[model samples]
Target: MSTHVLFIHGLWIHASAWRPWQDLFEERGYSTSAPGWPGDLETVAATRANPEGLNDVGISQICHHYADIIEGWDEKPLVVGHSFGGLIAQELIANDLVAAAVAIDPAPVKGVKVLPFSQLKSGLPVLGNPANKSRTVALTPKQFKYAFGNAITDEESDALHAAWTIPGPGRPLFEDATANFVRNSPAAVDTHTAVRGPLLLTSGTEDHTVPRSVTLAVAKLYADNTASVTEYHEYEGKGHSLTLDAGWTDVAEDVLAWLAAQGFAPAGAQGAAAAG
Candidate 1:
């Protein structure tokens, strides 16, 4: 049997963000986990009311959280992540804790160059606030609208805001410490090169937070790691909200197909196999 699948989430979001992916994998009979970032509230309502809870969520804490989940798995699971979670996935890979990984629009890791104006603009609030480094920071409605919901319509965007927007730890957003300081730490990458596991990176053509250039730059980092092989995909008109918007299911299906190709599933999974 293939290894289980584990998903790590990014800032301002919780494991619930992976619900669509979880549903798909569950249908395919694969065990899955969507462990929370430290202090992650289970629901959107709660998160809105308690943004400060996110303050305690730091890179080290979140990394250890995923590490615990990985330890409990029977085998080294295939790890996938988006945004800040992508950075976390790299950390686990460096530690030799995963069989495969997919980093979807990962945040800026140590040494990745070519920051996009949109990315810096999206992060301006946190970067502008000195206290953000050690606290939880919630986005103002305007800030949230631009950074995350610009591609979608106002109504749908408003709903998304109501449903998933929350304050998150700001440390990782501005984390400039050693790479090994947390997951994807610079030290870890240097000492633990050559993951030899399959790595996939998907970027949205219209993504602003992680522009096409930066995404490619990040891919080069993993390629630099001496990973046995790496795959890349770009979805047209897809934004930072690639996994939550209209075409999410197709994207999930594509990921499912890729996993099956990597032998993450049975041969029959190539067709209309049940969701794992």
Candidate 2:
């Protein structure tokens, strides 16, 4: 059977950012798709022209939007998500919608309590403005440099900012920050469930936005799961932009290897490997 892989992009970037990943997975015999959040425009230029489309979009809306897409698939997919997308992967897993999942530098959900100063600083662009809760917010190049490109060179950071940055909904940031205090917050996940499937949580050691401490805490939350597999991996010297960084394929290969070990290797991969 073909392994359907779903790629989920996070805030400040659009579904197009996963194009390279989709190509790589397809080459390995996996069918891939990357879906946009609700109200997302077709292109970055269009998103910039009318940023208001991203306003007031909360975490629940984004999750449900993707959940519907997953439900339409003929088979359960291997879900991979980055940053806020990572949190969404976990939420979908909690709903038993995926065959396996990989959350890379995912944002924190309720009960994850290892926030570092840098993580807080990275989120300040949205969290600092209470008014942003109902508005769309775009990160300044300087802010993007600090949050995502900290581990890369200035030129690379500038290039990435130019190519991938876009406006994002502000409400999800506020919702995640206050999730612990909110009753029945959409950011909540049932980590103890066996139906969550095999979950792999990856952390970039140098990631400022979702630091190692935060990812480690999230991994620990699932430590009590006896019926499902949960594993954690940390990439040395990597940053929040790991998915888009120069070493992105390395991370992707690691995920592929893990899936292979878990008995979910893409259909025809062995034949393709032999042909090569």
**Candidate 1 lDDT tens digits, 118-204:** 988988888887778888887776776677667777776666666667788878776733342456553234312664577778888
Which pairs in model 2 have colliding backbones? none
Against the true structure, what is each candidate's TM-score? 0.88, 0.97
Q: Residue 258 error for model 2, in Å?
A: 1.1
Question: Candidate 2 at 123: error in angstroms?
Answer: 0.5
Clashing residue pair totals per candidate (backbone < 3 A): 14, 0
Per-residue lDDT for 231 in model 1?
79
Question: lDDT of model 2 at residue 25?
Answer: 87
Q: Against the true structure, candidate 2 has what lDDT?
A: 0.89
